[model samples]
Target: MKFTVAICTYNGQDRIPEVLDGLQQQTNPEGIEWEVVVVDNNSSDRTAEVVSQYSKNWRGDSQLRYVFEATQGAGYARQRAIQEAKSDLIGFLDDDNLPKENWLVEAYRFGQEHPQAGVYGGIIHPKLDVPLPPYFNKIKSLLAINNPGSQPFRYQRNDKPRKVPAGAGCVVRQQAWKERVPKQLQLQGRDEKNKKTLLIGNEETEAFFYIQNSDWEIWHNPAMEIWHHLPSKRLEKEYLLKLSRGFGLANHKLRMVRLYPWQRPLMILLTPLYLLSDGYKLASYYLRYRHEFDSDLTKACELQARIGRFMSPFVRA
Candidate 1:
């Protein structure tokens, strides 16, 4: 069966080259036709220029194509790619990630081996120049490690047949996703006001949830890998704060999605407590790690509270 690699990018000029290069190097099966489709999510940078350059020069057997969507969201780009995919199997990779040469090969192999599964995900690693702190590394040990260009992970035990992840490195059947995900939920992407902000989080998680409920098996292959680049900006405290707030907002949205309508009322009561405790732990971590003092602690704490307030009324409304 033919497979199409769908990539979504937003202002990804500097990173797209390596990803394209990695794709060009991939070795596919003799009869399997593969192609790459890049959906540009309204990039203001030289992203289009870079991809255009690569498309012109790529020598791979798989075709390369670039499409532009002015809607300004990753979800929007992803949805467009899904619609345009020419293959029955669709693989997703971020512009910032460098996937392995045999990534799609392994994905197809697993799909053939277990025709029951609709979704499959591989490993991901952070391409960091500096070593993470001991505490962070310890936590990461339990999770996937990010190294530049190479990430290794052991396959999750297949004992429990549960919902699997479609985030990062994943290949999914087009027919399965179209049947399981609502058009409304697939509209994930960047916020219109601030292009840098993601409109949703846990989008893949939500999709996997639906797939699981549909009685589709989600598979995990630890052998396949992708190296995710981490810029210095992502390492800063402010960005981490933004990430936390976004995560909190996503949690709020999941509740609104009626995933747990019965538990929504409980969240309303627990939100304030949870935000306060989270703020305290983050504040302590900041005070210990960051030597310079800043009163942004107050602002950060207030932001978390504001998110809770915003979510509370939205659920009711």
Candidate 2:
């Protein structure tokens, strides 16, 4: 089967080298042909330079091509990838990740085994510089929260050909793309109801649901793994707060599909406790590492708390 690996990049020159090297190391399949197509989202950095170097120097049958997406967001880049892809089976790897040597081979194998499966996703593990704190670890295990200590993960489906949706290190079957992603994703945004805005974090998740609801399966194989590098600049408390606020925005947008109203009350009751507990733990780390706390961190926390309140009302709809 022929496959095209679609990569969406923005100012990702520093990280592209590792991703390129990892693809080069793939044990080439005999009859299977694969190539990497990078969609550059108006990068002002040396991304084009790095990709050009790889095209010239890399010794592989897999072709490399770069397309410019003048649009600003990731959704725009990904949309272009769908249109530009050469094969029906598409592999997606972020610029900041290194897929396992067998990533493509395994994905293709799974596709062959399950002809009806449209979306195939794999495991994403954080490449952390240091171990997480004890308290943070405990809270993570207890609360089932996902963040620095844990990478986003979906369980293998209970039913065969299940709906597993996560974008980080995954493959998309062409039929699945035509049926689910492009149309709804264009309208959905982060919320299921707000079909006007571009979908953010939950694009992949919603696609999985659509696939399963339409009678196709989603698969998650643990063996298909990718090492996701955490941005060094994002290792601070301020950064986590920013990340949390961004997550809150996505969550608030998603809450608009609420079937019940008590969701807001639940958030109101729970937000303070979560903030105090997680906040104190984060503060301890900030004090120890940066030796100073700033207003951005405070603002991020406030945004998250307020977002929770804002989301509560939507739950009733």
Stretches of candidate 2 above 4 Å error? 130-163, 184-200, 252-309, 312-317
Pairs in clash, predicted candidate 2: 161-217, 162-218, 187-195, 189-198, 189-199, 260-315, 260-316, 261-316, 264-312
Per-candidate total of colliding backbone pairs: 6, 9
What's the lDDT of the predicted structure labeled candidate 2?
0.62
lDDT of 2 by residue, 1-317 (tens): 38888888878888888899998888766556887899988788999999998999765678899888776666667778888898888888878778888887887776777777777676666665566443343222111122322233334434453334467777787777777653535222222122222224445565555555555666665556777766545456654554444444444333322213344467667656655655575555555545333534444444444454334333321
* Reference-based lDDT, each prediction: 0.66, 0.62
TM-score of each: 0.75, 0.70
Q: What would the TM-score be for candidate 1 when compared with the true structure?
A: 0.75
Per-residue lDDT of candidate 1, residues 211-267 (tens digit): 655656776677678887766665555654555455445555544443444656787
